[model samples]
Target: MFSLYALAQQAPSIDLIISNCKVINMADGSITQGQSVAIKNGKIIDVHSDKYIKNKYQAAQYIQAEGRYVMPGLWDMHMHFGGGDSTLHENKNFLALYLAHGVTSIRDMAADISKSVVKWRDEINNDQLTGPRIFTSGPKLEGYKPIWKGVLQVGTPEEVESALDSLQKLNVDFVKITENTLKPDIYLYALKAVKARGLRSSAHIPSSLTLNEVIDAGLNSVEHLGYAYNAGIPKAATASKASQFNAEYAKQQYRYMANHHVFITPTLLGSYIISHLDEDSHTNDAYLKYIGRGIKNTYSWRVDRAKNISAEASKQRHENYDNVSKILPLLQSEGVKIMAGTDAGYLNSFVYPGIGIHQELALMVKAGLSPLQALQASVVNSPAFLGLTEYGSVAKDKRADLILLDQNPIENIEATQKIHSVIVKGVVFDRRQLDKFLKDVADQNVSGL
Candidate 1:
């Protein structure tokens, strides 16, 4: 019985419904057919067959995904956003860049506009602006006589306490610690302080501490795969002169962290850009415009590093990538959670903001992750790590943070970006909208240049 009345049977009209899309069920590697996702207000209301939804609820708006692959919006876990402080409107512009690229949440590892970024983070949560949701660590912690900008310098235990106190007052989400910037004791102390306060701690693991020590001390996450790369070695050198000899030992040490359930962000996009900065490149990458002039110029320094790296250094650099590939499957098999991060910001050199994430997915695939596994590293694993309960998976009750791909991502990960449309917060953005946004970003950057 064709009941038009049944179509309006549902009382509360859904705000949006995405129909006829192939849902990428991350829970298991299977694709589901003919499913529709319905949303009301800002939350997902239902997921079911198109016929069932049509018979049950009326939607204010309906988006036809037209045979596209639908999966969760991605998270770039370690993007630095500090360079925006040099200008008046750069931070605001940076937010726009992130949203335009389907990056729904970003972990600002450290940024200079500590208070300003916090203000924006709150504002975004309150829907004050159209920007990606933020989790920030405010200023990085340094030991003393710090070289980097916007650091909380600590010399003694008291200084560490003072820094943590200041960070809490500033409403920092977590703490990001650096090696050269912090003494080994103070570094470990900061990690403990953050843990004692019930906040998560993530950082660039120092060579001073064993990977085993950092995990034992309650570090929540490792910033980059360099930590894992170093862990794979057999004999880690403590001195600068011996530094060259111990990389293999570092790789050897990673199995220990994997055994202990330590999660790591490889941030391979940043590695790829810096590693091959001289390899003929792509400019006007659609994401470049949203970057402010100061940070945009910072990218040139990457080329210098690439050119200056001796042949010996370059060979070893590639070997690090190889080491990463060798251990990734093992890490995954052992249930060591791996999250994807781009480290996509000024300090990263060649990595661009929005565009770098796709590059990162590719590198993860290159480094021994199955295409589906690589995609999950970028999409599913990240939100889970951040504790976004209703995000990441393409299922009922999840936020409508999803990308519509032209091809099956499970078969070919690069197909993940072949966007047919984007459904975020239940708002539909078609290819046309995406193209326009990217063009606007590029034109703005070119004008500034």
Candidate 2:
């Protein structure tokens, strides 16, 4: 007969254990203290009281949380990886930045670097690369002679079908259609086609299409707040008059969106940065050290464009951002889901990757969401929208993508920035390792690698 000590010594061994932590339940923002999480094979095998867990299992690696707060790793649902081949290496460097900032997953909303992005996505899943879980739309669909350099230009119904076929072949996470140069009719048709194929779709609604029309046509998400705001006003309204928030029309739009189960990725950080560029150029920003020369070079165009704007134009930009941001609370009240995303990548000016998602969360709180609501946008709503059932919680069977914070993010959204450690696929990255990720990227940037 095996003695008690012998049985304890033979307890099942797991990959890692995070003990004595407060686990934040993203489902409803509840906290369970004195908990221990056991992870094995990249999945949370069990979560129990620290005493119970310690007696029940042995782990190869252990993290003594020391009363820290633990939550699911964040997701940046709307970012990009573009700026052409020359910036590919610089863009690839963003992966480490995301992991360093406790972002374990990201959605690339279509960019010029689809091929590399797709390859990286698969490689990361297979443990061949180190980075956030990538969900990419691959190359987006556009019209003939589209302004974007990398796209599958389709003007006909048959072409749209073919474009979608290609996307399926690449096994993209979803379909992203933009309004830049795509015709309104084709855009509507593409949305319907994507829906018929049971593929999720997100888009920049065309000016010619009403918000109601796009929702009815099967657009799963509205990419930015400006698009939804524009839907509430008259098409004839000028840019200067776009700031007028129409309560009744917006209410109807919100209801329509909620009823259809559509999501909104406000990407507020990018707009906020651009709107306030006249005040802070971000040239002396400390985050610049981690960005490659090629990526930093891409920020010039947006900065120069903002510089030439008249004082009145700058004022209008600020007012527009403020007005549109106010609708976020209303959207939540009306039952619409918000996904926190920082349109952070090449050509978006100063919105830095990795850390940008934290800034986005703070902005969401400033725009009237509670800290929990903001947290849900990144960790909960984002994965649900992507149909990633295995993520978004620190529970049994959930993916072991988590972050240990120095403070409670539910109490203060900014607490996310105080990450003590990050775990991606059961591999723990302690403070030292996370800092090394940042330092390595910075060194690569300085060396022009």
Candidate 3:
């Protein structure tokens, strides 16, 4: 004997509900106050006024946002996870570091451990692993007998086709091409071919060609600011040849980048770390405790290279870093999309996985991007660059990858580093849990130096 009115009034069921928060809209940095967000099965089902959420829905779990600032989780667009077979476990530990720092997604630019990385990517997606969502370029493309390990070496058009065929079989998220022994023509050929196959591409623009040439050939993103900066130099049309520093040519190149809509990842922190190597030896960085021996050993070659340089050479290196960083604000003014990546991994010195992103945002701010713009580089621009439509904003029907900050990041970018909690795939990791994650990573075993 059920009342008809009662039978008709069943509340909607949701997996989790977050209440009493100010949601930051990355779309334009607006704040929707006193909102409640309902999530079901990892996707945000609805966002509404708190009263509507309380009246119409029931959830298995409730997280009180307590007037905190909630926005999409950070994304590190360029990082790596490889140090040959011996460092596999060591590299895997980086996942915990990333999550503890409120970074919920990472783009693994190719490394020597593609097989292990691809497996981990799937596990994370299927809920079998505890880590960020991984988007990887499976074993990058290289030229014949290239120096980099785990690359598909191609010397001719036929070889390029076969290499792309292999990448398709591996089901990579995108293709990464480097200039290490790769010929300029074949690099262009690979870009065009990858595009023809309907695949997205990222690459180290060959110094032999103008930046515009690669953009014309279908390169979606440039991996470093140095390359973009090189393009901005007058007649910098080619890296191998010397040309006058033409300010007009540089303006044209930047204008061209704006017109073509090319994406650029400055990876300022890593470059800055190297540029300042003369002053900061980084031998006593506290973050080094989390890095394993094998990975730390990988950092030696670059460190040695920096140390061996003469005083004049070191001065030039600092000048190069300063000059290249100047392009950041210019790119912003030109409407070029800039992605924030730390380049924090093997062979890159002192750039830790988790906390390095915050440093990157700070550097971007120092380079003339506003705090909102710096945050956008990570939360909004990274996803947009990769075309990952499921993320990049806090909205209804979006994936529940978010961060809750004690202070509004819009007001101060450093506030992002003060994370209160993180929600990954609708699962909440409160501050205590985040701290425990750091401890667990710290406690993992690594070999002695």
Alpha-carbon deviation at 122 in model 1, angstroms: 1.8
Model 3 misplaced stretches (Cα beyond 4 Å): 1-9, 236-248, 446-449
TM-score leader: 2
Assess the local accuracy of residue 409 in candidate 2 as a C-alpha lDDT between 0 and 100. 87
Give the per-residue lDDT digits (tens) of candidate 2, residues 1-449.
56987987889989999999999988788899999999999999999999999999999999999999999999999998999898888899999999999999999988888999999999998999999999999999988888776899999999999999999999999999998888889999999999999999999988788999999999999999888777667656565545555777788889889999999999999999999988998889999998888888878888888888999999989988998898899888888999999999888898999999999999999999999999999999999898879988899999999999999888888999999999999999999999999999999888878
TM-score of 2: 0.97
> Predictions ranked by TM-score, top down?
2, 3, 1
In order, candidate lDDTs are: 0.74, 0.92, 0.88
RMSD of model 3 against the true structure? 2.6
RMSD of each: 3.2, 1.6, 2.6
Question: How big is the positional error of residue 422 in model 2, measured in Å on the Cα after superposition?
Answer: 0.3
How would you encode candidate 1's per-residue C-alpha lDDT over 192-255 as one tens digit per residue? 8887888788887787787777877778788887666566554434553323434335444555
User: Which ten residues in a row are the worst by lDDT in model 3?
Assistant: 236-245
Give the TM-score comparing model 1 with the true structure, all chains together.
0.90
Give the Cα error of residue 393 in candidate 3, in Å. 1.2
